[model samples]
Target: MAEKTDDKGQTGQEFPGFDPKSVEAYVVKDPQALAMNFARALENLGKAASEWLGPRERGEIGDSVADPMTDLVKTLSKVTEYWISDPKRTLEAQTLLFSSYIGIWTRTLNQFSGQYSGQPVASETDTLPKDKRFADDDWMKNPFFALLRQLYLVTASWADKLVNEAEGLDEHTRHKAAFYVKQVTAALSPANFALTNPEVYRETVASNGANLVAGMKMFAEDIAAGGGDLRLRHTDATKFAIGRNMALTPGKVVAQSEVCEVIQYEPSTETVLKRPLLICPPWINKFYILDLNPQKSFIKWCVDQGHTVFVISWVNPDERHAKKDWESYMREGIDFALTTVEKATGERQVNAIGYCVGGTLLAATLAYHAQKKNSRIASATFLTTQVDFTHAGDLKVFVDEEQIAAMEKQMNAVGYLDGSKMATAFNMLRASELIWPYVVSNYLKGKEPMPFDLLYWNSDSTRMGAANHAYYLRNCYLNNTLSKGEMKLAGKTISLKDIKIPVYNLATREDHIAPPKSVFLGSSLFGGPVDFVLTGSGHIAGVVNPPDKQKYQYWTGGKAEGQYEDWLRGAEENRGSWWPHWHAWAEAKDDERVPARKPGGKALNAIADAPGTYVLERV
Candidate 1:
């Protein structure tokens, strides 16, 4: 048998075992420390079990997990029915799996016999997906792990195909099935398990199982922190504190309401835009995402650009605020912020911006204002906002009748949806990046994740009032009422077309929460002039991208008509952040200037420091 060298020059002889150098890399030196840590890890594991069981023992948690999962099972059943119901299709699926498995098995045998090509045999084309999970050398060097990786990828791809080609299912059902398939496949990936994952296997062996001990200890701590639920930690929570290191832009909470605190940021310039800027951030997460740090803070950037910034920091709602709905948010939250901004700036009209769900609420408010002929907001900007749900992306899969009903029942039980629930949902949108990577690093590698301001802000989840969430899911996602001229607000049917304010609608190209297509389609619903700009990156990074970072590009001069892809083709791509483009567009709307005002003006007095107590309230 001839030895084969891979692209990296490692020979076929390295196929079966952990190379000495590889094993030596993770070797633990202190036996005594390892033993002590192992014992501590075991103790923590026991504590974790105790924490998990304590709630069940006291009947604090319900055993009704299946109630919500029932919809998922039913949704997935449609795909199963499509395949299994037809004998020919079922056989085709089985044959596809068996053929792929046979190929992998043959390649494994060839490698073991030293009669293989150096190129990977992980997929049919000898090319693997660009997945970091299988980046370890052992994944391709070791026959066993290679076989597992290939088999898993083939099966997962087949599952996706099944959903895609399935017949007799409605579009919604098909989308839900496909989403569930991705989730199921992601969870069952070989990299998720210690024995199956080559890297974890090496770490465990070299550390004499010390890695497992540390991982278990961390797992216990995470479960305990989640109050018996596993709140997967993405970053070192202890390293971040609101207003201390994160959300560090100077400001003061000048006005407080039942639903929100209006923070008037200290102006950075001697003179500021006469029309104060009011930001409405989604209650689903803390407003601090926009003000994560001075470097990344959009609020700080706006202030520096001579805008008197006022932000609405929504409360982490509980049972008391569960009854508050969208109208409640409009009147008490946005309207309250507008009034506060007026008092603080001595301005009647202001430029307004909304992010994610916050943008949705702002759009509705604009429509309501249009109905009332209220021109308080001279210009409106929506960041990654969706007015139409036709192409709302994967999130719509979770908004069907059964799922929303289940969510309503759960939220009704507590008067508000737990912040963790929403956080988990958002994480699932990019589980491959958001959920699994952290799971592997934190619990399997026994490493504390790096402290990141953006991730810390992401982890600081906020509860949604029962009425508010239900109304949002139904009106925006389910009914698509907001885009249609049918959504009733403040006892009157309002339309986006009637809102004649100059609009700067910003959509991220890679946004999952609000798909670019949905945002583009939504632009047509507005009667006023809309400057629809598309920028690079996903939901958070795309919006928070600062010009100083010189990261990501933005597109302009494209009409938000026809397909998003079509518009994208004609759009001019410019280097760097979209902030400057937006700043130019907004300043064009109304660039009047006045002397910078204090945190609280002649009427309203300061309530607290910037980032307000409402944002500080944790779930």
Candidate 2:
């Protein structure tokens, strides 16, 4: 150990600049300044405390109970001893703690400033540092954190009252809550709490990483690290899909679920409809996520419905396709496949199933065809997808100019938004479920991460072009132009109110990425009647869950279906799968004729392949 000396009798190296009696922050970065300052504070506290305690200890004046309070004050003075004694250890501990929170807060703050994983506006200039991406104050004034802060305060207040009022309470159990509450509540202030008592702040921040505070690493850390991954394995998975039991028709008809997968359930059933169902999948994940395996496979389910379903599996993007934008996706991806579906089926119209962002593109394609009075889309279904970008949820935080600029800078450095970074950001959105708990079980508990279908699915993230994301964030979310009748598309502004086709949309109640408020709002934006159903679970699981599992509840029985909310109120409260409900709705809309064509036989001109290039890039 290095030999050290202190001028004030403290146990650490002396920083003569600081004098706590003067209460000045003299030595800015010197570690020794902290120890010296703490020592001086204790010395002053001791002198005054000794004077106050002398008479009280001897049993004199003001209700001798003041003696205990005086002793308490004196005991608190020992806090300085640790600071002045273990200076190096103190600094290291404090650094680890505060830096942990700084990491999360810093990144989260950026997203609100529109510093998204994908830069929506690559041309925009950067104005803020990464740390101060969007210092709008209101950006940091997040509803979640604000609510959390208030809760912490209430928790601290309640716990203190509980222990103080309940004489028989267990002190040990109560102390744990008290310690955690004290630190969390203070950190909730969010205004440089680190400067107050950095050690305390550091401990609080680092606790999130360590699971010392519940829900810190819920998504990022492996559950096994804490002990074992708690996620139950529902089924075995193949390269691209999972297994689950769902209820559908039995035969050779192509059936598509809101999850964006085509199920060929009973491949030998009598085929229906005039066209073989072709599924236009989003270019985000592997095709198997929709087809996973036997039980959970939506593709198998479709075949059982007596329809031949062909799905599009997109190729993962690389530097070669760096210039490819949304237009390329529309021209090469959607339109090209629609023609192939038409060719294969010999039918004028084929049902289209789109999911999440895929649903948006499908709607866009519908708009493109509707402009020309083209009637190829017989039916449409949107799964956790959106047309109107109002109330875009936490994802909005990352749509600001600064955030975009940062993304452009980062992406320009590599030509694409690194798939992993995007994955991490989404994980942080629901850190409680996606990140922290596992960290505890892994690094702290000494275990391995457990495997779940969702985790496997999540790990398979997709790369996005810098240009496409920029246009999406700006034109859709930032401007709210799509729902406002201001979105300019295909040489014209396509009004959603013009496409009077029947529609079915699925929204998840617990989805943080696409909240029900936002997803359900799209129902009202449509000109045609919409059957919007809110499902259980988050974005992915809610849509992928099979009806056979019966683990979900849905709301049904709405009005005559003129408006969104009207239908919502009248929709009777019910339980079980929305799959059956969707099936019935689909069957009612069908022509009951068997249609057999190759692929891309819809309305548009055929491009090259059946599913096309972009949709086939799967895991």
Candidate 3:
């Protein structure tokens, strides 16, 4: 044991070095002593919260050993004692405080959330049958869940060791240690604040928007004695969509396929598109992301652009569709969209635009087609999408063989990944962004939240087929073989190098979910001519960006020569929205402008509305 020196009376003194092997970034002295003491003052925070609001009665908080809020209170007490004794060594303590709040939030999220759209937590979907029985299987072994569990164990072990070993650690060191605690704790109980400290929750989630909407939801739930929110808390609507596997008819949209139905908006088209544009949206979300409303819908924009657009709205997966894998998605879901588009436009080759996971599936679809030598695709666009799974980020933290087995056990019982669980995982990824805002308003402020169009849109989540999710995780993230040109799908090694089609990959600069690095991986993965685009804003806004939102400014650095590495090295930096640049590129590649043909054919079928039926759910 090294004897550490501490000259505390003098505020300004050289920090003594501690054993580096014992801690993750050992400090010479506590730099944040005062701050740690401040956090220590919050020692009564738990009791205060308990008395003012209420004690947590949930399983994780009330039952689990890794419960964060309880741990926070304990750590706060220790810090307070240390502060009262010698406030100089408070950094580690302050970090512990940080851990308390963060851990509470993360753990709470883990406890409440049900399932994600397609992403798995811990099951081998390949061997399991697809259906509700798949989800019912024991998912404790899920890779994601395992990672989550390990996150808890590792954090606790490290935190405990740091506190036990360090001596004369200033407030700053204590705070740092505590912060480590918060990070792991938050990873487990991100939504804990919602139950323990709702005030903070609402503010974080609300953002620039007010809490009127969230409040309205609570009021509806209260009035109905828990009918959930009348307006829907982004999750309910999405979950409902997942369970039902059908688009919601919120009385706002009616699906139709008539030449007159589509042409009514266009008085007379001057030029016809050489290739039809087919839109493929992820089944996990409502198709409206492609063609949301007139202001944001890409489908509407494409249709108005004189390009015949056909959008696919996937049926929600249920117990019956649990066994349906990527094969089903390609053969049934996406193939249906392709056929519908081909029939509508009387064109064989068409442009395919896919968003998020839909983009992944689209690439797979084209692979299936290319393997069969049926190349009807002229050009393809991927928005904030990653074909290569090497850098998928926090989502990867949940993937591994052990976790996969655990999840397989659960999904095997249920037949499909649970939508609630999927939603929970995403929420954990962005706990502060998604959960906190609701906490502050409804619980602390006792106020209502404004109905934010964006939050409302975010709350909508969906489910995925068992085999499809299993195939994606195993082939993409865990294997890291997708970008390496080593992914086998539908009885064939799906090689990105084989497809010689023109590829356009778009990514957001500040995106957390789909980081630019991951999205840019497509350039190298695809052997075809490639164009890498850098967009402004986040994952959703970056892709959903209609020509000019002006909210963000984009810079293009990827070279247009189509080689990903060469583009990375030589990619020039430009200012302003790349939408114009994209349009120009599309126009140049487009064969020629011909006479506008009459809209519709024998394939035209009338259905109801814009957002389609799958996305609009009230529960």
Candidate 4:
């Protein structure tokens, strides 16, 4: 058997003053300064401890009747049994790991002896995934760190192979196993720690423990901000405010309900499309993601493109609104938006856009309307939404029967799931990118992250109403009822097949929340002329992409039929954002002209400014 090498290695990657040759370079020459900062760091750690315990002391923390991690342990145990159950299989796994380590050891010895060239020594077959965490040259140039990196990689790769190759395990179990393994490995990565991470170690030595002091102080403050939970700051929160800096698109809250507030943006163009545009954003986060700033504001872009835009800004639900379910969201939210759009623009019909879970709700609403012969919605556009959960990515791992029931018990106690809980789950999906990077930069390096509108919006999570969340998990993820035509909304059973309205289904190439394949499969569910467009980038960037920036490319002219791969093969790629392309497609549907409408028309009076008070409510 041949050993895998770093065929895809970082060849010319350089870090300033990263040479391991100077032992004196790492010496903490200033003992007094180091001691002083170390003491301060300890004080900050104490503060962090107090912040964590304060909530529990005041009985503000949720009761821990069910252990979520117990399920994780059990899931991993199953995988463990698959390997250890057979001695020969276990030996083979052990041999594979040992061989990899041996190869690394031999190469390091040869390099030290000046017998081996300073090039990749292993074969391409033995290559590991390109991990940005170990991008520092010390991970390769330094023998100690290089050995540690290889050992960790070999072990992680072995664990992954075990789950993937494991027989007799059900598909769901396997998925959960794989996801858990990845998470566990990510959490245990050497780069996350100050001592193990060469870069963090250098920073610590250079700063004479000052970085730790600052990092610990920030850690304490973040814990206090999260009400005892670590609300890790991915960006400088001080640099942004909802209406002042972010969500700056001018609009007015035309209508308000317990479940949502309908905001109608002030038109930018002299003449607007006869059919208004209603944007239904997921309640998992704030609606302002679409209106982050003037540069990235999708709402503003639509308003400028000659469309009267109305968005449903969902409330951050509390115990008082615990009973609000999916039907309530549809009736008081999406349906309410339609009504608000009509009042604000005097148009009975309007083009609708739904993003993520909001799109799932919109699909359900369309089906319900179809049965009742309601044709208020002229056309629909779905962005990174999953109507079919069959291919729904790792989010499904958190939605099994046992887990959902456990989650329901927790939500039932509080009447809603904490916004932070959902935020953590999302961050965990891309833990390597979202979680560890921030941990290294903010906590380990003792540095304040730069202000990023997208990350700020990412952290601004929204609470999930108990009833609504339960319905979604059970119907959408658990049974996959929505796509199967078995989901019941209100008193009637709703099917995606009944949604005959023209659809502009946009799936991003790299969407993790709603996988492209899942969205592609969902395109076939609607009984309409579906124009499925595949765009570049993930869930947020792909949808929020403006044509002016011309960042990622998009693909079109592919029929939403057969496998997603097949569709991709025949699709035509176009450079730049899909916003302009979508606008043209929508205009082609109904290009009738109407004078630009006011934020609040004669029928509906303005309740508040744009973005609304509902979005301002924090959990």
How do the residues 1-619 of candidate 2 rate in per-residue lDDT, one tens digit apiece? Answer: 2224567755641322222332222223444544554454345445434545554576542341113233323333343343445677467545644553454454444534435322212321231112221222322334233223323333445434433433333433233333333333333433322223222323333332222222223222223221222231112223333222212223221222212222222335554655455566666555555654456756666656656665655556666556666666666666665654554556557777787777777777677678889887878888888788765665664555555666666665556665655665576565534544443333233234565665666666677666666667677767777778777766788777777788888888788777776777777777788888887887877777777888778875542245545656676655776767776777778747664433323433333422223333432
Candidate 3, residues 405-431: lDDT per residue as tens digits? 656666666676666556656665665
Scored by lDDT, model 1 comes in at 0.86
Q: Over the stretch 109-157, how does candidate 1's per-residue lDDT look in tens digits? A: 8776666643574455553475788888777767677788888888898
Worst 10 residues of 1 by lDDT: 14-23
TM-score of each: 0.94, 0.57, 0.62, 0.95
Give the Cα lDDT of each candidate.
0.86, 0.53, 0.55, 0.88
Tell me the lDDT of model 3 at 302.
58
Off by over 4 Å in 3: 1-270, 558-575, 594-600, 617-619
Best by TM-score: 4
The alpha-carbon deviation from the true structure for residue 584 of candidate 3, after best TM-score superposition, in angstroms, is 2.1
What tens-digit string does per-residue lDDT give for candidate 4 at 467-528?
99999999999999988888988899888888889999999999999999999999999998
Residue pairs in clash, model 4: 4-126
Off by over 4 Å in 4: 1-22, 117-119, 124-126
Candidate 2 Cα lDDT to native: 0.53
Off by over 4 Å in 1: 1-43, 64-68, 121-123
Name the TM-score of candidate 1.
0.94
CA lDDT, candidate 4, residue 529: 91
